[model samples]
Target: MEVKDNVVIITGASSGIGLATAKLFAKNKSKVVLVARSKEKLDKLAVTLPNSLAIVCDMTNPHQIKKMIKKVLSNFGKIDVLINNAGQGYNSLLEEIELPKLRHIFDLDFVGPILAMQEVIPQMRKQGQGAIVNLSSGTTRMYLPGMSPYSSIKTALNVASHTSRLELAEDNIRVSLVYPYMTATDFEKNTLKSPRLSQSASENKDFGDLPPVDSPEKVAKMILKAVKTGKPEVFANPYLEKGELQV
Candidate 1:
């Protein structure tokens, strides 16, 4: 899909991968709509990007999501791309994790993306072509002792993205997923601090040395390449490789 002149909405755009992608899109001349819970940061970022609109939204809230979509359509007239990047993680064993927190992670990592897709599908169908890019963790391919909740939800998201790709094929709407290998984002810090995670994480603190990770800006470039080349997914890492994949 062409990035230029496209109406793109990126959730979690206040920072990290979302923010990096927003900057790239804006530079490419796409009408970028930045969504996040931080109004101050979004407003500040929007000022630097041409044709950018910032919508402060909690992806977990249905009402706020609907309003965000309405606002985007009212401003841009059409939605060409929806990037589902707003998500949080919990660092605890499944048995040790609280039930409510697990559900909340599911709501943000799984449900919110699907809800946003639901809202945009009608418009995409009317347009006859569009794209949905979902951010999923590369950790799903491996394993982590204290990352069951996060990895499981991301696994589910990867499946949903694949299925959506098949279901939306005839409509010319592409569904793509980005599996980011341990990027140097605030994810680890936030996950460790998450209240839903067990206190054991804070007490024991066996985090060890941080692994070398990709920068958000580099991953953002990979994502844009995936969208522009009609690639179904991106395995973003230092290697920065691509392949035709379906699962």
Candidate 2:
């Protein structure tokens, strides 16, 4: 989809990959709507980008999402693309993971994106064309031992993207999934983990053995390119020797 002169909504746009993507879109002259819990960061970013609006929204809250969509439509009149990039990590054994943490992760990783899609699709259908880029994880295919909880939720999102893509095709609303290999973002530092678990191994592994973590800027560019090209899926920093994903 052509981004110039279009309205693009990016969740988790306060920092990391979302922020990078928002900047790229803004550079292309897209009217950008930045959504995240950090009002200060959003406000700061809004000033830096031309034609950008920062909205403080907690994706887990349906009411906030409703107000967010209402506000976006009120300001921009239409949404051309929705980037579901609001998610976090939980690195711990299933047994060590608390029930509350599990529920929170599920809500943030899966339920929230589903609700955003529900609210945006109608507008897209009316417009007769739109694009949705959901951020899933590369770990979904790798299946790391301690990251099952986090990866599983993202897997559900991938499935939803696939189904939504097929269902929304008649309306010309394209849904794409982005699997970003470990990116050098603050995501891990912000992740929920137990105090009891030893962090040494995980911390060392993060900086060393795992596939080279792509920069947020790099991933952001790939995602935007995929949206422009109308690709259904994009995998960043693939682990395979061929380093090319079939999709």
Candidate 3:
């Protein structure tokens, strides 16, 4: 779909891919709504973007997700796109996984996006056409040690995204998934790391052989491509083809 003048809600808009996406959409003339728990950052970003709104929200909360959608609709009168980008990373070996932390990541990386999708569907349906771009990770295909919890949650989101695409096809709603390889971002710094896992990850030889890291701006362009082309999946890794994973 054409992004120009479209009302687009982007979760995790305070940083990384979401931040780049918000800026890119704003540049393209889309009405951008920045959503994140970082109130100051969102507010600051909103002010810099033309026709943008900042909504401080914790994506893990269903009520907050619902309220965010309502506010978007109230201000825009219609929803054109929903970008489910708010998520966190967790790292732990299977035996070392913390249940509470696992559950929190699950809520952030999987459940929250699904809830956001549920909240926006009615408005998208009312408009008779909309696009949803879900941010997934290339690590889902890497199957790296200490990444099971995080990758598994993203894998589940992959399933939801593709299934939603098929289910929403008749309604003229498009659901797309953007898979970003390791990008230069604060994700690593923010990730929940286990002591043992961190030490092991530091020694993992495989990481040293991986391709060059992608930038957030490159991933942001792939997201824009996903929405514009309505492709089921878009990859930020140049080494990857549509269905194949190189790393």
Alpha-carbon runs more than 4 Å astray in model 2: 206-210, 240-247
After superposition, the stretches of candidate 3 with alpha carbons farther than 4 Å from their true spots are 200-206, 242-247
The CA lDDT at 155 in model 3 is: 97
Which ten contiguous residues of candidate 2 have the minimum total lDDT? 238-247
Q: Candidate 3, which ten residues in sequence have the lowest lDDT sum?
A: 238-247
Residue-by-residue lDDT tens digits, candidate 1, 53-87: 99999999888999999999999899999999998
Tens digits of per-residue lDDT, candidate 3, 1-247, equal 9999999999999999999999999999999999999999998998899999999999999988889888988888988999999889999989999999999999999999999999889888998999999999987766677889998999999999999999999999999999998888888878998888677553354665668789999999999999899999888986554345445
Best by lDDT: 3
> What's the CA error at residue 66 for candidate 2, in Å?
0.8
> What TM-score do all the candidates reach, one by one?
0.90, 0.94, 0.95
lDDT head-to-head 1 vs 3, winner: 3
Clashes of each: 0, 0, 0
lDDT of 2 by residue, 1-247 (tens): 9999999999999999999999999999999999999999999999999999999999989999999999999999999999999999987887798888888989999999999999999999999999999999887776566887898899899899999999999999999988888788899888888665546445655445656668999889878987897788887765622343333
Candidate 2 local lDDT, residue 26: 95
Q: Which pairs in model 1 have colliding backbones?
A: none
Query: Which residue pairs in candidate 3 have backbone atoms (N, alpha carbon, C) closer than 3 angstroms, thus clashing?
Result: none
Prediction 1 global C-alpha lDDT = 0.86
